[model samples]
Target chain A: MSILVIAEHDNKELNPATLKTLTAAQAMGDDIHVLVAGEGCAAVADQVAKAAGVAKVLCADHAAYGHQLAENISALVVSLAKDYSHVVAPATTTGKNFMPRVAVLLDVAQVSDIISVESADTFRRPIYAGNAIATVKSDESIKVITVRATAFDAVAAEGGSASVDALDAVFESDKVRYVAEQVAASERPDLSSARVVISGGRGMQNGENFALLEKVADKLGAAIGASRAAVDAGFVPNDMQVGQTGKIVAPELYIAVGISGAIQHLAGMKDSKVIVAINKDEEAPIFQVADYGLVADLFDALPELENALS
Target chain B: MKILVAVKRVIDYNVKVRVKADQSDVDLSNVKMALNPFCEIAVEEAVRLKEKGTAEEVVVVSIGPKACQEQIRTALALGADRGIHIETDTMPDSLAVAKLLHKVVDEEQPQLVILGKQAIDSDNNQTGQMLSALTDMPQGTFASEVQVDGDKVNVTREVDGGLQTIELTLPAIVTTDLRLNEPRYASLPNIMKAKRKPLDVKTPESLGVELGSKVSVLKVEAPAERSAGVKVADIAELVDKLKNEAKVL
Candidate 1:
């Protein structure tokens, strides 16, 4: 039984989460192949071919897959489903959008966001905001899964000599038309791939105060993130949210400023290597998960921390 | 003019869940249950569409044990017109559920179908997309805002980067995101009116669909606990600790 892993890229660079998915795929019987589905993604496909465990790369270059639309990619993936025993992708927004359609097109079920693969047929996933973990066994002939990228360590991106193939299929969903996407621009590293992250919560009060975090994040070369409360308060964009329903990140260091960590927020970043929480409220739940807790006003702590770091 | 919304009953968000002694599943023997938060948002969106005169009827559906009717009724109390309950003991995976929903779609001929992105129990996040595939309809998942126009529906989705807007043909599928709408609490009078609303019950077999879980629960366990460390009195010590003790800096 072999595995076909889906690759995620921004036309120019690959999302590190795809490599983590590759790591998970390598563990599940290793005739591991990858799919780079996009317009002009030949370079991305070449990059995927160099991943240490990959055996082959399939680059599906078509206009319909330019935005990595689910409607287009689902058909392309489903078209190739019959040849493999397992299909895996990282549990990102793009993968989550398409894999379900592939499973239904193949008349199979999807096992989503598994943290661990107990066996080829069995997996473990978090439920109820990580309060409990469920070990599930699949009965389907062809297994469809989305791996939680935070749970698996990425394999080295080099040291392989796999061949790349072009898929000549024009998969399109005619009823839906993609218009435009507004991506937030920042000079700092991406939240998912960054080694250090600094997050703010509701106590930041408003968007203006986030500048404090910007300075500190700049000093540390860290990415900026926000709790759900901060996003809900209109202090940050939803993309900056770090919680159960938001981006799950596991950086080398996570600094939470004024964030009263909800269980959902904790679920996303609790896996970080070292967590530091700064909140005036001593009883804040964030302290429980923080390796270092500071009970002080963030207004005072932010500038002082910035000064101290500089 | 008809909108169909899918609701799911899950462990109450407030209750601290406990792992069963046998590790079969979470101990749900006598725990309080509520409508999944995301589903509540779905119901709210459907009701708002009706209230705005964009939809003539709002129908809520739940696929689960008989107790799931409570969730359907909650949707009714929140302004849905009627309810449909797909009764089953064994929960079906997203594909089977989508197949069953596809059958319902064929019979009901609704103009729109709305569902929560995923359920809290299994968290598959696949059913709405699967239903759209099985039914040959366009879909918009993780929608934060929805606007319906004649022959078309504009969906603004909360994508990973920021926002992505897409236009889908009418009679489409949309899965709700948390920021879509604020679900209202059922008032006393509305709750009373909901009890009298029509609620039809059927089974997967009755609908001519075979439903079963493709993924079986092998075990359940509590996650590893995060051990707490010491608190810092000031920023200087915190920076000192990060530079030397943790070595992350």
Candidate 2:
């Protein structure tokens, strides 16, 4: 059985999450084909060719694919779905946006945000905001899944040639049209792809205090995150929020500052390998899951921590 | 323009869900149920569109057990004109739900369809997209802002990285995000009047749609409990442990 992985990338660089998807793809079997669809993603196709265990790379470069609109991508994926037994993509916004369409077109139920591979057609996914996990078995002919990228290791990039094939599928536009995109500009790693993340909570007080998190994140080379309370309070953008309603992150190290850990927030990041929490409240819920807890004001603690690291 | 808003019944968000001892599913013996919070936002958005004179009719629909009609009445209480309950005991898979919705769309032909991004109970954010694909219509998922202009609708979606704006023609599907709008509580008069609103109930057989299960649950288990860690006395010791012992920083 072969697995088809859709590569996530801009025209310039392949997202690191794509490699993680390859890891899950490899677990299914050795014959893994990566499909790179974009306006001008020949370089991305070349990069995927170097990834280990990749049998082939299919490149579908067309103007309609520049923004990866759900309509066009779903059409392309539906055409490609005929040749593969399993189709996989990282459970990022892009993958979640389009995979369901592919599943409906193919008449299969899409397995979403899977955290573990039980078997070829079985998987484990979080339910009730990660309060519980449900093991599911697919009864359909074709298995469509979106893997949680952080749960798997990224396949190593080694020199190899994956035969590139150009798919000849007609582009059909839907009612949706891409108007514009404004990507958040950050020097730190992207949260979804980052192995280490540092998040702030309401304990930080306001948006200006987020700079403290940026400094510590710079020291550890980690991505900055926030709790739902912080995001709701306007201390950070909603994209930076991590919780049941926000992004689910499982990094190597997760440091939470000034955040009282609510159950919803814990559901998102409790799976991190190492957790450290700094909160003035002694009974904050975050301390329950933290491997290291510090009961102190983040205002005084942040500078000291940064200086010590420096 | 006429609008259709879909809602789901789920465990109230405030209640903590416990896994059954057998691990087959959650223990829902006597737990209170409420309208899915996100779906309430969807209903509120549709009602607001009508109140703002952009929509002439707002119809709500829910596909679940007969008891789900309570949620439909709640939607009506929130200003929805009417409701259609596709009664079923089993939770249909996303593809099946989309198919049933497609049948409804064929019959109703509403100008727009809005739904919660995903149900809190299943947390599968697929029905909206699947419905869009099945109908070959445009979809704006996880929308934070929506503006209607003549024949086109502009939506700002809440994506992981940031926000993205997409423009789609009418007769499209739009799933609401957290920031889309604050759902309003039903007033006393509206709650009393909701008892009089028209509600049509039909079974899966009556709808002539096959409710098939594509994926089956094998087991359910609670997440591993995280043990509490040591609390450092001060910043000096905390920094020392992080750098010297933990070696993460």
lDDT of 1 at B191: 98
lDDT of 1 by residue, B133-208 (tens): 9888899999999999998999989887788889999889999999998899999999999999999998998999
lDDT of 2 by residue, B132-222 (tens): 9998879999999999999999989998779999999988899999999999989999999998999998787877988878799999999
Tell me the TM-score for chain B of model 1: 0.98
The reply for model 2, stretches above 4 Å from the true place, is: none
Please list all clashing residue pairs in model 1, or write none if there are none.
none
The runs of at least 3 residues in candidate 1 whose Cα sits more than 4 Å from the true structure, single-residue gaps closed, are none
Can you tell me the DockQ of model 2?
A: 0.84
lDDT per residue for candidate 2 within A1-310, as digits (tens), equals 7889999988768988899889888777778999898988899999999998899999999878888889999889888888888999988888989999999999899999888887888899998888889999998888999988878888887767788888656575857788988789988898866878999998888999999988988888999999999988988899998889998888888999998999889988998988999998999989999989998889898888888778
* A304: Cα error in model 1, Å: 1.4
